[model samples]
Target: MNFFLETLRFIGLCLYYTLEYIFLLFIPVRKKNVAGEIVLITGSGSGIGRLMALKFARLGATLVLWDINGEGNKETARLARKIGAIRVHNYACDCSKRQEIYRVADQVKKEVGDVSILINNAGIVTGNRFLEAPDLLIEKTVEVNTMSNFWTVKAFLPAMLAANHGHLVTIASMAGLVGSNGLADYCASKFGAVGFAESLMLEMAVQGKTGVKTTIVCPYFINTGMFDGCKTKWPSLLPVLEPEYVAERIVSGVLRNDIYILMPRSLYFLYALKSIFSTKAFIPAAEYLGLFTVMDTFRGHTKKAEDKHQKTGTKTPRSLN
Candidate 1:
């Protein structure tokens, strides 16, 4: 096409999408029906994962729950069934292992059929400073929070591509978009998760797979026991989020096909500032917001609880699934 025509078309589309965004602010988008859709959730044993599963169950979707904790996963499945999930399947699969993800994914395909929605919510945090953190724990964090997303998507995306209908949800963190002190490893992993999800979304669009959707969640610290003793500097401005609230927002976002769901609303402005302000300017703002000292009291899980979990081969009671 000629340059003039192409430029005019581009400007027209920009205005069209801008108007759509403004219009939708006051008029809520209709949520899509999820009844009978198969939804798979990793780390479904506890925290936001379990909460999301229950919500989906109530929406009449079949639930496939995966977690390293067999007992905990079973409990989640039981609760899902109790809450009205007609077909609830629980699998004790360690998401940190690529082979395990593939193996369990194959089983899910044969046993439960194609999953229409996939939530990569399994994650772990060492809650240690960069220097003090153990090397193994750092690796484990990356394997679970980042690499596992790659494996899970590869396992199920092909089916979604063929059918051109699927939803991919990434349960990342605000740390993914902006770095925080005392979370070097954790931040790295979540950053990778956010990047991977964004790239996947672009790839789907490039492939003309409009039916396949993606939702990337970047919420501030949630009170899911993962950040046990961590406190917000300004409770009113950036209060620690509740797992129930986060889970509800996530499901709602996915149903509406919203691409990015940053919690607490305030996060939207903070993330926007990251792009507009210089690094030096942003650092002070972040510090004043308590990003630097937020993890000073982050005691992830007590040693006693961890020991009990190790002995019983179950999940740490305080850990977020």
Candidate 2:
């Protein structure tokens, strides 16, 4: 009888939440205030990370920026200060190293206070086929793109859990959801990231930590020089997003406490089809959408554009965040 009652309650909640989601879609949700909040964004040296820092700076949030590129990170801090951010801090820490992440995180807590908003924006992609990709590059991809989130959360989540108030954001990719050709390591890392974020969110809810918010962003390719040579067969449907636009949407979603932020809006429909359709049906759709050959011409960042991207890789493997 108890089980039956609980099942009925779950059914009722499912319907109610469905209606709520549809209703909220038609109207804007109220955005929460981030003013005075300490926001730590990894990979803030350039690309989307830098853009997000500027946006948060404008919104009156204290910015903590991290990047392997010290010069670029300082440049971003300078830009933030130029745009009216008075309390911006930049750190030269490689996300690929766990000890570096923990060390910098401790420094941040002591110097800047507890980070109220943690954005795990640091990531890397090899843009090579599975067999053709170098082993070191694969390990680096996983370390930077997936394992970094775990270390960052471990370093700072205690404070958030204690206070029951904080936001954790992961800048994942659409490749996290679906597979693509020639991006095996990149896809696997993103998949791990997506799973970690989702599971952590569920754990927070299960622990009744209502004030702790988690956002997982899965965006399409962006024109940030990371995927410089990548192409889209359907430009109108899945146009390579602009860095500024992605940064704006991410900040907006964080403020709104959105759990999932999929870029291009069309991704929502496509992802839905993944669950609703069978494997036989999905493969053809993916092929039609050019997922199989999306990375056929991926050139990553050229020498001149490396500074604009987030990563500093060795000569052998081209890495981008």
Candidate 3:
């Protein structure tokens, strides 16, 4: 009876803390002016990245846009300038390459200023089954999604450490927290990203670097062409998030120096439930409830599309998971 009471107390305490955190997250805090802050964003050419870039730019930040696509990079810069950015610099570089990232870092420091914020947002997904996925695709996915964070952090974190003030934001995914079929490579990469971000946070805490904040964002599918045909069985429960909504949340989270930013907020409780329940019970229950089937259908559709493209002489556009 004592143990049961203690467990109840613990659960109640956790619930109280979670509710408090959610309230704080929903209420935006006014931030100090970022007029002179220099911000670098990877994959700033499109989707959530583009929206984030605009958000920062509107706040009078000096923007540095990086994308492998030169045209998109240029367009982002133009938009940032139009949005009232104090300064805008666009670069076309493959973030997956360490040398390229280093080169860009050097140029950014010289051309712009010491980066006050770094958003490691570049990512790619090949919607192929695990076994059917080519080795190169897997390597590239890991390189772009996971290893790029390592390179970007190494290159830019030194300045932040020296200044004793900075923000590091990593745009991870829901796949990192929960596995899904047809997203083996994507899941692996995002999981690595989450691990890396968590470890970095621990290191920062151990070092007593409170001024330097790190935020890891795990959001579900966005309304971008990347996850073109993806569908959820319970659309009302797990609706597709808008890129603008995600961008707004990310901007607000960073300003608040939040440690973990989970979109839709309800997932925090779901994650806790998963942690407390036994896999034998939870897995079968989730499967019977159609959670597994929803993801399986999404994966199967992508696989079928890939197979069809392979049979025909046409290439399918890449889709984000």
Using all chains and alpha carbons, the TM-scores for the candidates as numbered come to 0.93, 0.94, 0.85
Residue-by-residue lDDT tens digits, candidate 1, 192-246 = 9999999999999999999999999999989888888899999999999988999
lDDT of 3 at 71: 92
> Could you give candidate 3's per-residue lDDT for residues 167-276 as a string of tens digits?
88999998888777778899999999999999998888898888789999999888766776677656666778998899999997887777888876766776677788
Clashes of 2: 0
Which pairs clash inside model 2? none
Ten residues in sequence with the least summed lDDT for candidate 1: 312-321
Q: Where is the poorest 10-residue window by lDDT in model 2?
A: 312-321
Number of the top-ranking candidate, with TM-score as the measure: 2
Q: Which parts of model 2 are misplaced by more than 4 Å? A: 1-3, 302-321
Model 2 agreement with the true structure over 1-321: per-residue lDDT tens digits: 699999999999999999999999899899999999999999999899999999999999999999998998999999999999999999999999999999999999999999999999987787788999879889999999999999999998999999999999999999999988898899999999999999999999999999999999999999998887889999988999999899999999999999999998999999998999987987799898899899998877643345444455444335432
Indicate the worst ten consecutive residues by lDDT in candidate 3. 293-302
Ranking by lDDT: 1, 2, 3
**lDDT of candidates 1 onward, in order:** 0.92, 0.92, 0.83
User: Comparing candidate 1 with candidate 2, which one achieves the higher lDDT?
Assistant: 1
lDDT of model 1 at residue 206?
96
